[model samples]
Target: MYLFKKAKESIVSSLHGDKSSPIIKINYICNCILKITLAICLWLSSLSFLALYLNADIINKSLFQLFSLSSLILSCLSFIILKRKNGTYILAKIKMYPFSFKDLVDVSLLTGVVTISVFDIILCYLYLLVAFAVFVIATCSIYECLDNPYMRDNENISSFSLSFISVLYMGLYVISNGVIFRNLPYNPLEYMGYIIKNIIEDIFSVTKKLTKLII
Candidate 1:
C-alpha cells in the first residue's frame, strides 16, 4: 500500500511536468484492488471452462455454479469500488471518457463474443469477436491516453496524428491476425500472422510520423 502510494505520488509529480513539492496522490486503491480481483476472477472463470471441457463428469454442474458465484462476487466488488468514484463525473472534467457502466457492458459483450467465437467448434463464428474486441479496446485505450488531461499536448498536432496511426495499426493487425485463421488453427501460420501484424503495425506507424511532418 505504501509503495503504491509512493508510485502514485511519483506519477503525479511527473505528470505535472516539474519537480513538485506536495502532491496529493489520488487514493484509487479500491479501483486497483477491484481491477486485480477482476483479472483473477476472469482467469478462474476461463480455467473453470477448460476444466469442464476436459473433465465433464466432475466439472459439468459445478462449472456453472462456480461461474455464477464468481460473476456475482466480481459484480459486487465492481459496484463497491465504483460507487464512490463515479468515474463519469471525474472524467467529464478532463474531457475524457470515464470508466462507467457502459464500459462494463462493452467489455462483457466483448468477452462473451470473443470466447464463444474462439472456443466454439462447428458453426463457429471464427475469431471475429476477439479481433473486434482487440480493435475496440485498443482504440479506446489509445484515445483515452492521448486525450488524458495529465499528459495531452493540445498544441502538438503530431501527438494526435501519432495516436491516430497507432490505433489504426492495432485495428488492422488484430483484424488480420485474429479473424483470418480461426478455422485453420495452424501453429506456424498463427505465429506468422502475429509477426506480420507487428510488421504491418509498425509500417503504418511510420505514416503517422510522415503525416505529422507534412501537416
Candidate 2:
C-alpha cells in the first residue's frame, strides 16, 4: 500500500515536472530494488526448472536454444533502444509488445534471467559466476550514471556514454570468455589470456580500418 501510494505520487510529480520532490528519489530507489529482485528471482527459477528436468535431452536442447536466442535478440534490441532517438516510439509500433518500459529495468531483468538460464546449460559454474558478476556491475554502473547529478545536468558527459561504457565492459567480458552457441570447454585462466589477446587484436583491427578510411 505504501509502495503503491509512493508510485502514484512519483508519477504525478514526474508529469508535473516536480523534480525536487523527495518521492521521486524514493520511487527511483524502490524501482531499482524491485527490478533487481525480480531479475534474481527469474534467474533462480529458470535454473531450478532446468535442473529439475536435466534428463530430458530434447526439451533441454530446445529450451537452451530458445532462451539463448531470445537473450541475444533482446540484448541487441535493448542496446538499440538505449542508443537511439525515438526508440520508444519505434517499439510501440511493434505488434503484441508486452512491456511498457523498454529501458534499463526491462533490459536488465530479461538479460539476467536469460543469461543465467543459457549459461547454466552450457558453461561451467565459474563462467556463470563471472557473467552474473558482470551483469551486476553493469546494472549498477548504469543506475549510478543515470542517477548522477553531474551526468544528468551535463549535456557533454551524457548518461548514454556511461551506459555505453557499461555495455563495453560486459562485451569485453563475454568476448574473453568466448561464449558462443556451441558449448566448448575451457580453463578460466586460459580464458583470461584469450581476453588479452582478443583485446590487442581488436585494437589493431580497428586501427587498420580507421587508417584505410582516412586514406
TM for every model, in the order presented, reads 0.24, 0.22
- Candidate 2 structure quality by residue, lDDT tens digits, 68-165: 33334334433444334433323221111112111111112222221112221222223234445545656666666667666655453324443554
Residues 1-215, model 1: lDDT tens digits: 43344455445645675322211112233244334445544554455455455554531243234443443454344444345334322212111111121211211222222111111221111122333343454465466555656345565433343344335536445443333233222466655665566556666778888999999
* lDDT to native, each model: 0.39, 0.40
Error of 2 at 155 (Å): 7.7
**Model 1 stretches astray by more than 4 angstroms:** 1-26, 59-64, 67-69, 72-215
Query: What TM value does model 1 have?
Result: 0.24
Least accurate stretch of 10 residues (summed lDDT) in model 1?
Answer: 115-124
User: For candidate 2, which ten residues in a row score worst on lDDT?
Assistant: 95-104
